[model samples]
Target: MDVTFGFLLLFVATFLVAGLVKGVTGMGLPTVAVGMLGSAVSPVTAAAMLVIPSLVTNVWQLLNGPSLGALLRRLWPMMLAILLGTVASTALLVEGDSRWSGMALGGALVAYAAYALLSPSTSVPGRWERPLAPLVGLVTGVLTGATGVFTLPAVPWLQSLRLPRDVLVQALGLAFTVSTVALALGLGRLGEFRLGQLGWSTAGIVPALVGMALGQAVRSRISQQRFRQFFLAFLILLGLELAIRALL
Candidate 1:
């Protein structure tokens, strides 16, 4: 794709908004960026663009949290499963029909948002976590390979673990960081990710970081519950638009 001025503007704007969402909520950067950009670019291209920014932000999120050693010890199975699942689905990364991918992306967003809105208090038992973690990771990896979004069962499953707030945030960062690297590897293997796109993807870091800072500032002053409700509602609208466009 040509690096037209308008495209650059849109790219920056998209990441800025996406970064803000992640800053406030501890996740959603890739989902929001890819969902918005998928309308204008192919899902493959959008996923490629998100590779660097997502990696950087998520790595930061991962490192800043508590007990990295413990988290990895407990979550390694799931992380490995995510990698294997992504590798298994690498072909889908390049061969997917854009329309179908769009619908898939939209469906993912809608499902995640709806679950967050309606689900009552829930928890995954300790024994169940041992058995269920890999399953969730594998499903999340396949979905990430196909749609460039990694928040479906992964996020919900994480929430159900009932970690403390900070630990949960760190866990999300670790999962997303793994997913981003796995997706990048899949894209690289298929030759869909190219050097030319790096310039734009790299440039996105500035806006994304700026947006995160602003969002963190706002997060301190506002009701997170209210903001989250608003965010989910916006996601529903965006998801519906993407789905409708795909069907048309």
Candidate 2:
């Protein structure tokens, strides 16, 4: 895709919205970006564009966590599963393909949106982690590899783990960072990565960061429940639109 001025603006705007959503809700950047931009361009392109900013933000999250050592010790199995799943899925599905990949990405978005809007619950028993970690990791990793959105079961599932607030946030960051790195490697292996796309993705971080800052400034003013409702509704529409486009 030639990076036209109009599309460039649209791309930046999308990231701004994504960043703001993340600021308000602690998630949604990848879901929003992939769902909206994937419809406009190829999902592959959208996924590629997300690499830098997403990685940077998640890395910040990963670095800020004080309990990294413990989290790593407890989370290694799940992380390893995620890596395996991502590598396998990306190798098989994402490279050298755009049409079916778009369809699948759209489907994943729709499913995730539906889950968020309908059965939203935040709490996971820590006891369940022993059995569910690998399963969650595999699913999330596959989703990350294919659609560049890894939060579906991961975020809510982690929330269910009911870790301390700070630890949960950091854990989510580590999960995202791991998935992002895996996806980056997968894209690189498939030769889908380009210097131009990397440049654009990196440049996009500025608007995203700016939007996050603005969102933080105003987050206290808005009703978080209502904001989440609206955000999920938007995601549903975006996901459906992309799914329809994929069929066409």
In terms of TM-score, the best-performing candidate is: 1
Clashes of each: 0, 3
**Model 2, residue 199: C-alpha shift (Å):** 1.3
| Model 1 per-residue lDDT tens digits across residues 1-248 | 56678877788899999989877777878867876786679767788888899989899889987778999999999998888788678677688665776687678778767776786455788889989899999998887777677766677788678676667768988999999999889888888789977766787888888887777677557664565565566567656766776787
Instruction: Give per-model TM-scores.
Output: 0.87, 0.78
The superposed Cα distance between candidate 2 and the true structure at residue 125, in angstroms, equals: 3.6
Cα miss at 79, model 2 (Å)? 1.7
lDDT of each: 0.79, 0.72
For candidate 2, what is the TM-score?
A: 0.78
Off by over 4 Å in 1: 98-116, 222-245
- Tens-place lDDT per residue, model 2, 90-150, is 8554644545655665676667667767765645666777888999899878866765667
TM-score of 1: 0.87
lDDT of 2 at 38: 65
